[model samples]
Target: MVEQVDILVVGGGVNGVGIARDAAGRGLSVWLCERDDLAAHTSSASTKLIHGGLRYLEQFEFALVGKALAEREVLLRAAPHIIWPLRFVLPHQPHLRPAWMIRLGLFLYDHLGRGRRTLPGSRRVRFGKHVTGEPLRADFSVGFVYSDAWVQDARLVVLNAMDAARRGVHIETHTRCVSARRDGEGWTAELESRDGSRHFVKARALVNAAGPWAASFLDDVAHVKHQHSLRLIKGSHIVVPKIFEHRYAYIFQQPDRRIVFAIPYERDFTLIGTTDVEYKDDPSHPTITAEETSYLCDAANRYFKKQLTPDDVVWSYSGVRPLLQDEAGSASEVTRDYLLDIDQNGPPLLNVFGGKLTTYRKLSEEAVDKLAPLLGNHQPAWTADARPLPGGGERDIDELLADVRATRPWLPETFAWRLVHSYGTRARDLLGEADGLNALGEHFGADLYQAEVDYLVRHEWATEAEDILWRRSKLGLRVTPPDVQRLTDYLSTKR
Candidate 1:
């Protein structure tokens, strides 16, 4: 039997789920399918920041910067549990960029976006007296501090899918849209699950939110013609032991004019990234090259008093960015802004191209706005003024954390903090009627108990151990291999 819906969204990344949530909330019947887990690819492999690309100012992308800056506050309000303010320290480098230039750019970043509240503006700091100066090389005496936000990137994607599901959208993870054909007034799509089961759907409209695979999906999967082109760039990051003792992150200016960041990660480690190299390989499973690893270490070594080598890297990840093709000399210079192409030659098909995490909500809002009218639905834009995403109703995260700890006095401080930051009010739901740690369920490793694991499987569509350890939470940094095997065995039995 072929099920029918008003819209069928292909891809489960940020934009895909974001659109699903927006469309479903507007009373449209929405169905979304992903070839792998939610955020299994590019969406999860971000530098994990929500900011008004300070560097984009150099590229003269003022419009993009302004749009992103506005979304920063909206996202913080939407998901305070996973998104919060972060201060970035930029050590002075007179030889690379002048102080005046930096100041001018920051001034625009502060004032360009509307509804900028809660976050402080940029200011200069003395490395000799400030806590951010403790780990920098002695040569750096003055620097600038700016505000941005950090996010659990993968969790952000899942939460959008969760919100969409709650609003009556059908979310199918581990399901692939094998073929989509426009027939008469709508589309007939064949979807295949990982277990080799196939299902069919008929929809009034189709949305292609495939990120890195957007273009190829048009050619190979959908077999459609398009005038759009994508420039694939590989960006890689490395995680090492904490390089600094402070809570502040560092943004270093390289001689090549690109910037690298060393941010706090997983409580005990430091995250450094991102080299932009032109890529021409399969987007799936792009591994970090040794040269890329050395590049990140050298970038950090240039700024920190403590030197680093490739051997110091505890973990690494890489992703291919499907940037909109433009006349640019370098990969890093390609536009981070996105484009929405609506092919109205047949039944309306919207193709999403070239977006960063900071502007996903806005991109989604626009995508739905364009399509909703085409489908004869006149729902006004509502996501901006909507309530926070599930588990994010509480505005003050610190107060929520304290309340959880107060209610569950037996919960350890670190464990309680993790839960509150990861789930906000939903942490209590995970605890249920449990009175103590033992009642929570069997301890797999670290702070992970069976209760949380079961909650992930039941509520968040988690299937694999990596989904729990790496994506849902960064517990992979602490969980033993034996513990992972135990979790895998348990999941197998549940299946």
Candidate 2:
């Protein structure tokens, strides 16, 4: 079958979804195709922070810092549910960069950006005074507290896709674009769906937003050559038992001067990581290396009261960052800035290179702006100051929570707050007019209810049980194997 659209976006990662959403909102007919499930790759495997890279200050990347910091507030306001303010405690170590440099970086970070809303600026915390500093070693007398945002990376992609679809973008999951060719005036793209269906889509413009596969898609799939090259750097993270009492995440400096984040994840686990190493292998199946694990563990062990080893790790994941090579000596030093390669020889194909989660919206807006001329009469960028995500459209979460409590007063305050944090205003959408715990149908463990699973399957495009247990929600930490089996069987029946 042959279909036509104004624009075709090839990857369903954050960048691709962002582009599709922007393009669709701009009144362009758009089609977004993802080979695997949305966010099945690097977008979901991020460090899960929407912060201005504090460490990037060392690299003197002021422009990136400003852009990210500005977007932090933009996203927090846009999706206050999944994205919220996080306080980071950076304990000073003697061996690391001196206190002066740290202070300088923090000062620049505070002043680099213009607008600040929910999050406060950097402040010095005393180990004896603040509860967050209590877990630190006695020698760590002082620390700096700065603002950043934590994002549900996977759902962020989903929210963008949802918005795109709502704004008239055709979203196809498990559909891979095998080839693309320019036919006289426009472009012809071939796609294969999950059910062994073949499709040919013709479009005025094509966007190669494939995360790690940007180069591969351009060269092999699109049959075009690119001047820029993508440098794949594998960054891995380990989820271990919660080691600290504070709600604030820790930003620790390693011996090699690389900073590792010990973030509070899923309420019960401390998510620590990220080792940056050159990865030349497949981006699809990047595995956590022992050396990276050791590096992360060592970095965590430096400041935390409890030591972490491979055995303590419950889950480990690695993501290959499709970085635009800028001739940096080390992978860690590579710039996180994205590049738009627009080819106007025929129909323009905008290939996005390197970008972090924090800067995706801006990147998308800029990308569409670049391709606007090719598709004459394109709509102006409208995503810069958008409102809440699909479920997070409301301004008041407390009001929504009160509504949820009224509906299900049996929900404990903490657990109810957890649901509110996860689902935002959509808490009622899942719990729906259910009066009590039983009305929620079944308790699968943790805060997970049967109603939530149904809502995910129906509205959020949840296919597998793991998608519900892990990515969609962190109920995997609490749900039993038998419960998971039951859910899996139920999902199978739905198919």
Candidate 3:
């Protein structure tokens, strides 16, 4: 007898996991598979902001902006630890955009989609009075301060998958759906694991949420007829030493009618990014080009007093965004909005295309709302008001931090902050019955210990150093080559 499920989701990106979580919560048997580790692609390679795309307003994407804004509010409530409020300071460049236009855009952003219930509204600020202006060039006399939120993007994807697993969704990472064939009664597919183990699955419905590979999955695996096209655009980011010490992040308006952000990342570095170059290479192995690095440096240099060079870049990453093809002129101008295509002629099928990080929950809810009914699941949608994601139970993050400090005074301040912020309430479980750092286990490097690695491998499906160091956490930035080798050795035993 072959294994079967109500839904078979192909992809482990944000949308794939989001759909699994929603479907499982609504009482559906779901099985989701990913060829690589979860969020090892576009989901982890975001600009890490949970904002209504402020620049999109110029393109008149009002509906998309409002939809994203509403999702932002919901996500904040559901995952307070990994996702929290962040203020952005955009230095005024009169030539690029007028002050009134920005003010109008901010007003609309603040009030869109039920308005700013918990986050602060945007306002104009003078450079002479504000602290964020100190790092900017002397030419910027004034700027606008607005509210958005920052995310541990990869962690967001993991938490969604964990929550889905809790709700009885079967998650298979490092496993690929090699072939999927739709029979009139249901769909059957062959799954191949990384270790060469194989299995078959039958499903009542299939969802192709394969981020950058959605179209390819349809063309190759599902063998279904469809007209959707995905324009692969590569966006790259460079990490340099901390350029600004302020808590606030910067969003610089580029002369090319684009925007680049300089945000505090991993405590010690500033994250600057993102060029919209059309890409034709493999999505999995995308790396930042020298030109992209210089472009980002220049984008920051235009407004920042501390100049950046290619040598200053400590790390870099690039991800191919599989945007839904449109008639847009430039790659930068393409819509970040997603489209959910559902075909219900025989066994149901759903396809998700071209979505940004900010709107995954809404997209998932909408996807399940369409597919769940076809499988006879009449359960009402519940993820919007559902319980918080894994380890995000604590609403008052500061209070939780204070309590943890009071209880574990031996824990270093920075270490404690990282723990509380990264794992939240689950930090207690990871530190269970331990009084000192040494008890946590062998030191891998920096603050990483054997205990944390063990916890990750057991709970978060972390099988390799790359998954733990880069995706699950940014500890890769602080670790040495030998340290990585040691981690690799340890994970090899685990796998």
Give per-residue lDDT, candidate 1, residue 486.
95
For candidate 3, report its TM-score: 0.99
- State how far residue 483 of model 3 sits from its true place (Å): 0.6
Q: Which ten residues in a row have the lowest lDDT in candidate 3?
A: 112-121
Cα-based lDDT for every prediction? 0.93, 0.86, 0.92
lDDT of 3 at 70: 91
- Candidates 2 and 3: which is better by lDDT? 3
Per-residue alpha-carbon lDDT of candidate 3 for residues 369-407, written as tens digits (9 for 90 to 100): 999889888999999888899988999999999988899
lDDT of 1 by residue, 1-495 (tens): 999999999999999999999999899999999999899999888999999999999999999999998999999999999999999999989999999999998889888785747799999999889998888889999999999999999999999999999999999988999999999899999999989999999999999999999998899888999999999999999999998888888888999999999999988999998999999999989999999999999999998889999999999999888899999999999999999999998899999999999899999999999999989999988898789988999999999999999989999999999999999899999999899999989889999999999999999989999889988998998989999999999887765
RMSD of 3: 0.9
- Deviation in Å, model 1, residue 493 alpha carbon: 2.0
Sorting all predicted structures by lDDT, with the top scorer first, yields 1, 3, 2
Deviating ranges (above 4 Å) for candidate 2: 116-118, 442-446
Clashing pairs in 2: none
lDDT of 2 by residue, 1-495 (tens): 578898999999999999999888878899989998788889988999998899999899999999998888889888988887888999888677888888899998887776765678898888788887666666788888998889989989988888888899988878999999988777899999878889899999999999899998988889897787989999999999899877899999888888899999887789997889999998898999888888898888878767778999988889999998987998899999989989888888888999999999999999989987688856777886877888787667777778777767788987788788777877767777777778887677766778887888777778788778767877787788888888888788765
Better candidate by TM-score, 1 or 2: 1
